[model samples]
Target: MYARDVRERVDAGRWPDVAAVPEASTARTAITRRVLRHALGRLPLLVRFPDGTRLGLGGPLVDVHDPVAFHRRIGRSGLIGFGESYLAGEWDAPDLVAALTVLASRAAELVPAPLQRLRGLWAPRHPEAQRGTPDGARENIGAHYDLSNELFALFLDETLTYSSAVFRSLPASWERMAPAQRHKIDRLLDLARVGAGTRVLEIGTGWGELALRAAARGAHVTSLTLSAEQRTLALERVAEAGLADRVSVELCDYREATGTYDAVLSVEMIEAVGAEFWPAYFEAVDARLAPGGRAALQAITMPHDRLRASRDTFTWIQKYVFPGGLIPSTQAIESVTASRTSLRLTRRDGYGAHYAETLRLWRERFTDRAAHVGALGFDATFRRLWTFYLAYSEAGFRSGYLDVQQYLFTKDAARTDGAPRETATSTTARDTTTAAAEGETAP
Candidate 1:
């Protein structure tokens, strides 16, 4: 705790110093220019600065509103400071997602290879205080999810599903997002084989959509969540859906959950498990799973090398977005399960492009409902931060730097399969899904 306090104090003092500085040092500009040239040269991106200066060969434009601050921040903090620039509104792009996609495509090479391993020397460590302890988890989860249901409502579809939505195919626009979201959940429910007489356990119930769906299928569900705001509304939604008798919503930690379930599922919740407690999280799932039971998880994953290199390093996403979150690679998940538990990775369906489209639709919806979001008491800065977050995520997928996947994990893989799936697999969505699948996909 003392160490965390000291680090927080240092960061508090440092960001102000950076923000107050009027100009970058001559040496800093030289470094920034060199990095930009190598980093942006291969990409078709145009970077416009305050002084009418520009960089990049030219695709979409990155308008650097405060070049000096940006340069200084980059010189000091590297990629994280670039995100801070976005939060500070120091830079923008004509098409934010497109411009970010250009950068995300080169994220691996942005700082040069030799320096990548050196990130530990300066990269922020995930704070000790933010570990997923019972109390810490609630505080961190509430920082984003419990802010306001109305705030999320401004942007999300009627379903209120916050994670990546899988689509049959990438839609051209936002009009089809609602149905696509249902389809996404449908696939997970299918993977878990939720049906009549099934005793299902769902972790991280986001507004009761999954629970409602499970109940609709005549399955009895016990759903867990940390957000009080979400729990209230989720229960209300369950009652409204007239499935209250079949579904139970509890305000509890995953570690606190008891009783066995015939099937277990969590949607995009493992990211918040923190690497330290991943084993415990899986253990909780294992303990709750009945013999021959199945588990399906939707995850967001990064490439293995990137996940390994950056898993312990904190970033803008951890700072201003989802605190205590980490995108686990397939290797990390497989290794954790193999070493720590009996569950085996049986099948995976990945659709990174689908996530890009899902994010695009959410960003558009968020922007289109800006006034409503503002009226919900979120300030302009909040809007900017969230906009950047959504766009940044969209870019990650667009560049194939990130992927969303559904995985079927079972205790007995040989005994589990041959049941009919609700949907066919796709290279993008489900067609490519297979029981023999071996690569990583995310929840």
Candidate 2:
């Protein structure tokens, strides 16, 4: 009989007594008894085993009730269980990530939630923020990127780029690929053409890696960021790199940044501006660039009307993680930049796989450093929430639900009709090259 049926019978006190056959081994009987005990605890909840065993939580199962709803909520053993259960609030584990890690690395299993079946037909849609003011931008950027710098540092590469990494190959090497990220960033810098003595401007400078790299290339760089922590950390990085004279990090919103630059680059930042404000973002970039300057941007893109039918992960992210953030499609970015000051899409690359790898690395780092993370003032629940964020994102990328892109933008003037630089290198050239070759989608 199905577990659900057994559960119902057990609930009505009609459960059968333990079989006492002489042929049954004592160990086997004991194992069955123990499983039944656990199942009894999940009485009302249906626990699904990967082997098609439906265990009822009534009767003997009640003796082994899940104190934390671990079995009742997440029947499957892995990241999905922890993430799905936490999102549904079925279980209350102090560290969501930790709880998930245990299940993720365990034996094969899947536990389905009863509520998902009940609410399968319901879906609520929200209006997209077509337009947003500077205030809105500040709120969105701060909400997601402003999470603890220490947490970010623990997992990110030396550059600390929060966006997708460019991998050199499929299933990129973790042991031999430490230098892949450096090459990818260098390629982006070359695309911008910010060379020695070039006056460069960077918008949404999260963690200041790009700004520091530009300065290291001998460029006079001005960087803008909305997060106070980011600005502080960036300034510290600049000072340590002895680029204080050439690099200036400002705690200002992008809308307020004004100046002419030999080149401009904004990595994974424009998506937060919303579609309505995209024109302003392009204009801001145009205004800051010199007559022949180039601009490069990296962002995540989705299809038109994407996420309409799928679960609204955005709803959860908006409410709990990224308050006002939004992701736009490539069409949106193209439309916004088409009209103003003749822009050309010089090169394009997709680093979705790189991002997946990055997330995996983050998951490992976070799992390994759980103790330190707990010590950093984040409670167990917060840890689980953070883990869910990374794991689901990793799964999303692996499953092709998310993408990352790098675009090279050049002014009509910079197009001098001359061929652009094909490749570039940095002190961390090997790392960047490995990443670019593995994950980078060549244009």
The numbered model that scores best in lDDT is 1
Question: 193-244 in candidate 1: lDDT tens per residue?
Answer: 8899899999999998999998999999999999999999999999998998
Per-residue lDDT of 1-443 in model 2, one digit per residue for the tens? 22233223231222111011023445544543454346333443344443444555322111112223333323221223333344333433343333333333221222233423432333233334412577666666676677789977777766777766565566765553345666666777877877799998988878888888888899998999889888888888889989999998888877788878888888888766755567778878877777667887888766554522233333444544566556776656665565554566656666666777777877877888888887887655566567767875675566455677777777667534233323322221121223345444323
- Top candidate, metric TM-score: 1
| CA lDDT of each prediction against the hidden true structure | 0.78, 0.60
Worst 10 residues of 1 by lDDT: 417-426
Q: Give the TM-score of candidate 1.
A: 0.87
Residue 61 Cα positional deviation in candidate 1, in Å, after optimal superposition: 1.0
Off by over 4 Å in 1: 1-30, 413-443
Compared with the true structure, the alpha-carbon lDDT of candidate 2 equals 0.60
